[model samples]
Target: MSTEVKDGLRISVLSSGSTGNVTYIESPHERLLIDAGLSGKRIEKLMGDIDRSLTDVNALLVTHEHTDHRKAVGILARRYEQLDVYANQGTWDAMAPRIGKVDLAQKHLFAPDTVQTFGDIDVESFSVSHDAAEPQFYAIHYEGKTFVILTDTGYVSEHVEGVIKNADAYLLECNHDVEMLRMGDYSWPLKQRILGDKGHLSNEEGADVLMDVLGNRTKRIYLGHRSLHNNMQSLCHLTVASMMENQDFGVGHDFELLDTQPEQATPLVTL
Candidate 1:
């Protein structure tokens, strides 16, 4: 049966941070969750806050095996019986024990660079530099519009740039401010790990990535996966905004810049 088409593409970040991460995306006919890091109950509540429900979710996409990214994958799939869970084989293997008791039929494994279609939306995965066994980001395409998902990467690579460039909307990471992170209470090793190439993106790096990928076609950018202890929402927004202004890109005129909160769901963004 054909799924009904809605207005266009809609995205809602249910939660974003080192604590837990989840995003909801819908393309008229299909609805899916990208990384159910939050518990199933939390995800449901967040969706309900946005006037959506778990009952409509057709699938779940796992970005990596990290608890903050895959914590509720299995529970959400099992609760919603019809939900299929997609992940790379490496991610699946690493996360399987944690997720627990997922039906074989619900598992949909794909290698990096694989493209899968669900109704009108086409989902593609690409590798990201992260500490996880295997971590990746996604690009969602629908009706000629592209919405890219990028977070938890220590740095953006050439391939990642290619995948995200000139997109209509971007959910990108601005995880922390280097100075804040360095001076914060985290241990030296923890600090180094976060500063490493396999760690999270710094605010500066996020700005650089935005500069690389954003173009005339870019409409909106959501700064996500911020570090609660080391980063402030205002800081992430202003840092990126300042960079854009310095480059002659008007914050409100060139594109919209917004930050996703770790504890609350962002309003539905239509693209």
Candidate 2:
């Protein structure tokens, strides 16, 4: 018998939410990050929880140019002086303010369906629905296994659905419960955007996505990108639990939440 993963493939939620966002995925030969939204120091500490350092990241994959998702990307890249940023051109232009004056050679741009490698990990980006210039989620093939990360989007589209359907592990967005968002104190315009076709996913929508995507192959689940005012951790937890359990999606065997609060440091899961 052999381990499902032989080359040490793993992922850690570096940080997530409106404040900052970051997640690290690594393999014996491939080292990468999904987003770099936190400050340099904050991101370093988050990675330290999983015994990794900024220098260990081979590349940074940008989903969009939002402040919470790009704030630390340039700093992380510049400090390590080696991180290759992977994103579309529009997102790059939108991110110019944060990336500072990066060297031209360090930028790595790829269109949808294109795949690239970091050491041995094969990363493929697919378009996601959002208001940003062009946001994307990634599916990584490594050590003979596949994992997809879906986050920071207004809604899930056909392309995002296809990629996630076959994933082994998913770190997905479970932003807010509808009632909470509608009744919460957020301003009208902001609330409208949050509920728009290109806004973040609500708890019900997140659960619906799970109902459609979670299959026998999914090993673990991490609900993430929750809004503080628009969602309660308990509500988010119960909603997902009910959805999976009601659907009989291998209850308790593969379900969890990725905390988005600034103060949480949960144990890193290697799948």
Error of 1 at 136 (Å): 0.7
- Superposing all C-alpha atoms, what RMSD in Å does each candidate have to the true structure? 1.9, 3.5
Q: Write the per-residue lDDT of candidate 2 for residues 1-271, one digit (tens) a residue.
A: 1123234568777676667778788777667888878777888887777677777677888988998888877787778777888888889988887579777777889776678877888988888878898888788888766777787777787767877685677778888889988998999998999898888988788888978887766777777888878888888888887776887776576544444554355566667
Best candidate according to lDDT: 1
**Which residue pairs in model 2 clash with each other?**
154-199, 154-200
Once fitted onto the true fold, the runs of candidate 2 whose alpha carbons sit more than 4 angstroms away are 1-6, 254-263
List model 1 lDDT by residue over 182-264, tens digit each: 88999999999999999999898999999988989998999999998889989889899998789888689878998888769
TM-score for candidate 2: 0.92
Pull out the clashing pairs in model 1: 6-28
Give per-model TM-scores: 0.97, 0.92
Question: What RMSD value applies to candidate 2?
Answer: 3.5
